[model samples]
Target: MSKRKGEISREKILSSAEYLFAANGYHGTTVSQIVREAGLTQAAFYLYFKSKEEILDEIFLNFERQLDQFVETGQQLNQHNFSEVEKHLTQTYIGLFQLFGANKNVIKIVFNEGGQGEKLRRRIVNQIHTNMTQNQSLGILKPEINTEVFAELLVASIERIAIRYGIDEDYSPAYLGHSLAGILFQGVLTKNT
Candidate 1:
C-alpha cells in the first residue's frame, strides 16, 4: 500500500527534524530549519507539528515506541544453563547493537540533549535491572551481585559502545555482541594475574 500524501509529508518533516536535531542539537534547531530541510512550508509543517518542541516530543515518542517494542521482543537472560545464558546474552546484545545502530541519530540527540534523555536512560536501566534481578533469583547471576549497580553499568557501557563502534561501523553487531558477552562473563583481568 502506498503512503498517503499527508503521511509522506509528515514523515518528511519528521526525518528532516530528526536529522537537524541530531546535527544541530535540539535547542539549536528551529522549526523553520526543519520545514526548509523537509522541503515543506511553515503551514505544511504546522499541519503535522505544532512547534519545534512538539517535533522533538514526537521524535522521542517514536523512539520510545521502538524501544518498547525491542524490550518486548528482547528475551530475558536464560536460566537453563551457562551456555544458554551466554547465547541469550549475546543475542540480546546483538539486537541492541542493531537497534542502536539503526537509530544512531536519535541516540545522539537523546544522549547529548538533557531532560528526556535522563528519563529514557532510566527506563532502559530499569528494564535491565529487572532482567538482572530475575536472573539473580534463578541463580543464573550470583545473589551477592547488586543487580541495580550491574544494570546501570550494563546500560552505560552499552550506550557508550553503541554510540562509538556501533554507530561508526567499526565492529559488526555479531562481533560486538559476542565481545561484550565475553567481557561481562569473564573479567578483564587475566586469570594468571
Candidate 2:
C-alpha cells in the first residue's frame, strides 16, 4: 500500500513536471513552480528526485521512450526490401506530433524550448546509431562520413520536418518523410521506367 502510494505521488510529480517543462523549457521551469503546481511540498519533491536536472533527465528519457520504441520496432519489422525502415521512421516522426495533437508541448520541450545538453540528445541519438549500424550492415546507409554525423543529420532533418509540418500545415510530416526517404534512396533525378 505504501509503495503504491509513493509510486502514485512520483507519477503525479512527473506528470506535473512534464507539462511544466514542456510548456516552459528546462531552464525556465523551476522546482518550486513544479512543486507548487503539483500541489506537493518541496520536501515531497526532493523525496522523489534530488534536483531539477534529475527530473529533466527522467522526463527526457521518458519522452524518448515512445519514439524510441517505434524506431526499435521498425528494425525488427519483416520487410523483404527493407526500405520499410524509412517508412516506419517517417510514420514515427509524423506520429510524434499527431500523437500529441496541436499541443506542441512535447516538441517544445524536446527541441525548441532548449537547455538540454548532449546527454539526453545522445541517448536518443544512440537509437539512431543502432539503426545506422543495421543500415551499414545491410548496405542501406553509406559509410563515407562517420555514422554519428550522419545520424545527427538524419535526426535534425526529421526534427525540422516535424516542426514544419506540425506548425505550418502546408506540409505533412508523414508525406514529407516518405518523399524524403524516397529521394535519399533513389536520388533527385527521375528514372526512366
Candidate 3:
C-alpha cells in the first residue's frame, strides 16, 4: 500500500479502535478485533500503533490537543462578555461531547479507567487547571477558591456528565452540555456582594 493509503488505514484503525474501546472496556478490547473492525491486517494495525493500549493513548492525546485548542480559543472569546463566556463554554462542552461521542470506549477507557490511560493525563489535568484559573481571573469562577481543587471538581463533573451521555445514545450532548453550563454560569455570575 502507498504511504497515503497506509495513513488512511491508520486513521480507520484508530476510529475503529475508539469505538471498540468505548463499547467494550479497554482490557476487553483486543488487537485482532480492532484489525477486523478496521478491515486491516494485524500488520497494518502495527504500522500505526503498537498495541491496543497505544491506541487509547493516541486517542487521549488527540483529545487533549483538540480540547486545549478549544479552551484557548474559548478563553479569548470569554474576555469581552460574560454572556459570550457562557456561549463559548456551552459550545466547547458540546464539542467535547461530540468528540467523545465517537465512542464511549474512550470515555470508559480514558476518562474513568483513563486515570492512568496516558502520559498526557498530566497535560490534561494542567490544562483544566489553567482554564479554571483563567475563568477565575475573568470573574466567572470564584477567584478566592483554590484553582487546583476547582479544576479537579470541574473535571469530575465533566467526566460524570460525559459518561452519562455516552451511555444514553438518545441523550442530546448539546442540551446536557448547555444545562451544565447553565449551572456553572449561575455559579459564576450570581453575585455574593
Which candidate number would show the highest TM-score if scored against the true structure? 1
**Decoy 2 TM-score against native:** 0.67
lDDT tens readout by residue for model 2, 98-193: 643454566667775445535556766777778677767777666674778777877677677666766556665566656667665577876774
Cα error of candidate 2 at position 45, Å: 2.1
| TM-scores of the models, in the order given | 0.92, 0.67, 0.73
Best by lDDT: 1
Q: Please, what is the whole-model Cα lDDT of each candidate in the order they appear?
A: 0.84, 0.69, 0.73
Better candidate by TM-score, 1 or 2: 1
lDDT of 3 by residue, 1-193 (tens): 4578878898899989888877776787899999999999999988778778788778877766666765465357556576566788788877777766765665666755546654455666667788778777877766688988766676677778877764566677787778778887666554755
Task: List clash counts for every candidate, in order.
Answer: 0, 0, 4
Give the backbone clash total of model 1.
0
Clashing pairs in 3: 21-105, 22-104, 22-105, 110-114
Worst 10 residues of 2 by lDDT: 71-80
Worst 10 residues of 1 by lDDT: 70-79
